[model samples]
Target: MSTTISTVALGDDIAALPRARPAPPARRRPPLKLAALWPRVRGWLLAWPVPLAVLALWQLAASYQWIPAQILPAPLTVAATFVDLFNTGELQSNTLISLQRVLFGFLTGAVLGLALGVAMGLSPLVKDYLYPTFKAFAQVPSLGWLPLLMMVVGIDEALKIILIAKSTFVPITLNTYKGLQGVPSSYIEVAKVYGFNRWQMLRRVVLPAAFPPIWNGVRYGLTHSWLALVGVELLASSEGLGFLIVYGRQLYQLDVVLAAVVVVGAVGYALDKILALIEARLLRWRRDAF
Candidate 1:
């Protein structure tokens, strides 16, 4: 009778305890479209603030006349000048000419740089014989060579191309040589252990290892070529974006100068971005390998 009483008390105590409630329905996520779109939107959001702030500051300065309009024209004035140039087809033609020169010069320099770099990297004798002369040559700015090059090639397309190529060549050759030299000795040893021949070793081990720096060189080479092209145009050519800047300054049309400057910056940024995309694509394998 006592045992039954105790059991009944225990049952009552159990019944008095709170029951477990079900979890609230899993919170629903937003649609997949929105999820994917967020990243791109976020990227733009992150990128836009600086430029927007600069624009605001520029507008403020213009409105307040903090700087003379003649020296630093309003942003809108520059935009109008850009539009006018575009309408006249002057901007497009000049831009195309600059692009052509950069491409031609960059290609020429890149090819020669690759060859020279590879030779120096692979052959000690070649490096020893050429490095001193190359270093001295590189020390001289492209402009320093102008007087001599002008005498040799005259003030023509050849002169501009040679200056641009020289500008490109130094960086490319240096990077390529360093890249090749930087490859791990262990990697070469491993390749040799696997019986890799010269071609096989280079193709499978050396080139892959060195490619990143070589590609970097190519990108730098292009940038150097662009800078050289602009300098050459400014001093010599009657046509091209650089000349436009000179023309605007001469006429005291600061807006036109700013417009041309804007275009130059935009083009350089775009080219760099293009090269970056290509680099990312080509080096995707590195991500997996690591």
Candidate 2:
């Protein structure tokens, strides 16, 4: 009878205990649309508002003669000038010439800069000998070299190319050096423990770590080269986009000058966009690249 009473008490205690509750159902997300996949496209479209507003204000100013037409030129007039230049193929020829010059200069400078940067980065002795001189030379602007380049290379294609190359070289070398310097000592130690040869170490460890800054330098170098090319052309050449601006000015055609300026800005923007696309594709592995 006591055992029965104890069993009854145990059963009552078990019934008094709280039971486990079931989990709520998982949320079901909506399927993504095609447009939803490309956030960059939306970002790019959003960027047009500022430019469009500026353009609208410019047109308004032109319509009201807020600025003298002789100096500012109406947007419509500039458009007409662009159409004329395009039909004549003059714009195309000049643009092509400028692009070719920049490409040649950029390639040469990038190659040489990479070599010099790697040398200085890897060798303390080379850095000690060359870095100070390079920094000093780099303090001088691209146009500052024009006079010396004119004396040495003359007012020819060679002079323009050399100046552009110099503009490109400085940023690339500096960035490459900085990138190499920032590589983790721990990474190098690990590489050493793994018995990596010099080439293996550079290929497997250094290049990956240094690529981001190096790529940034290359982008900046390209921009510098373009600007330097225009400056060189303005000072010396008779057949490039800069000369088109000078020629328009000489003829008192503000519209022509504005048209040329527009082309210059458009081309530069296009170059940057191209470089950005290339960077994005190549560095997709990076967390914050581009």
- The most accurate candidate by lDDT is 1
Provide the TM-score for each candidate, comma-separated. Answer: 0.84, 0.84
Per-residue lDDT tens digits for candidate 1, residues 181-262, read: 9999999999999999999999999989999999999999999899999999898888888899999989999999999999
Model 2 weakest lDDT span, ten residues long: 281-290
lDDT of each: 0.93, 0.92
Q: What TM-score, to 2 decimals, does candidate 2 have? A: 0.84
Query: Residue 56: error of model 2 in Å?
Result: 1.4
Evaluated at residue 54, the lDDT of candidate 1 is: 99
Q: Which stretches of candidate 1 lie over 4 Å from their true place?
A: 1-46
lDDT score, candidate 2, position 112: 86
* lDDT, candidate 1, at 105: 90
